[model samples]
Target: MEIVIPEGSGPIAVHGFARPRPERAEELERLLLSFVAPTRAEPGAWQYQVHRDAADPTTLVFYELWRSRDDLRAHLAQPDLARFQRDRMHYLREDLEIHWLTPLTAEAP
Candidate 1:
C-alpha cells in the first residue's frame, strides 16, 4: 500500500485515544517506541512521532510524514503492525481516529 503524494507535500497526522489503563500505558509506550526506529528507516517516511497527552496519559497522538499516502498505507500493512494494533486495541478505551494532513503552502526550495 504505497501512497503516492506530491513532492514537498505536508505530513499526515493521525490522532486517537486508547483505553485509560495505567497498567498498560508503559507497555503501550514500549511497543510504540519499538516501531519508531524501523518506521523512520522506511523509504517514504520523513518523520514519525508519538506523543502522550499531558492531561491524559492514556491519550496517544501520532504525527507521521510520508512521501505519499501510499507509503503510510504500506507502513500500516507491515507484518508486525498487526501485533502493534492488537496490543493497543487490547487496552484501548475508545476507537481510534485517523486524519490525513496536507501542507497549506508549497514553498520553493
Candidate 2:
C-alpha cells in the first residue's frame, strides 16, 4: 500500500522503514498488515499504508498522514498501535527509521 501526503502545513507526514529478523519475517509481516484497517478507520488519519520490499522480503516500510501532530499522537496512543509497538521489535532486526515531515510543496494530477 501507499499514501501520498497533500502539500500543506496542517497535516503531518510520517514515513518509516523496518527490517525484521529473518526468522520472524512471516510473523512480523502479519502483525504489520493488521494495522491497515484500524489505522485507516482513524478520524484523523488522512492515509496509511504498509509496504514490503521486493528485493528484501524482510524489509518493511510505511507511510502515514495525519490531520495534525495531535492526531498522530492519538494514533500512537491507540490500543492497536500499542500492541504493535510491543510486538514489532520482538520480530525486528534493526530499529525503525521514522521521520516526521512537513510538506512544503507537492504536485498532484
Candidate 3:
C-alpha cells in the first residue's frame, strides 16, 4: 500500500515500554524483534527502534514513527500483530502502554 502524507503535517510517533515475566524475558525479546523487519518494510514506516534496558534487562522499550495515524492503524491490523497480542500474555507481566507523541522541537545536543 502507498502512503501519502499531507503537507505540513508531522509524523505520528509511538513510544512504549514493555516488561516481561523475568523468566520469559528472552522469549519475549525474540518475539518483539520479530516485528522489526516486517514493520520497517511497510510503506509508512519512517523509523522503528526497539530498545532494551541496560540495568533492567527484562524491560524493553519501543520507539516508532509512522507517516500518520492511519498508517499506524494499518500496522496494528497486520496479522503478526494479532498473533503477537494473543501470545503476549504468556510472557508479559503487565500491559504495554503506548502513547502518541506530537513533536514540537528536535535538536542536537
Show where candidate 3 strays beyond 4 Å.
Answer: 1-10, 105-109
Clashing pairs in 3: none
Worst 10 residues of 1 by lDDT: 1-10
Error of 1 at 13 (Å): 4.0
Please, what are the lDDT tens digits per residue for candidate 3 over residues 2-76?
A: 222333455677787889998889888888899999999987887788998788767899998877667777897
Off by over 4 Å in 2: 1-9, 105-109
Worst 10 residues of 2 by lDDT: 1-10
Question: What number of clashing residue pairs does each candidate have, in the order they appear?
Answer: 6, 0, 0
lDDT agreement with native, every candidate: 0.65, 0.76, 0.76
Question: Per-residue lDDT of 1-109 in model 2, one digit per residue for the tens?
Answer: 2223344457788888889888988888787888889988888888889998789766898998777777777888899776777666688787777776884552221
Prediction 2 TM-score vs. true: 0.80
Clashing pairs in 2: none
Model 1 C-alpha lDDT versus the unseen true structure? 0.65
**Local accuracy of candidate 1 as per-residue lDDT tens digits, 6-63:** 3443455444444435677787677777889999988778777888878976777777
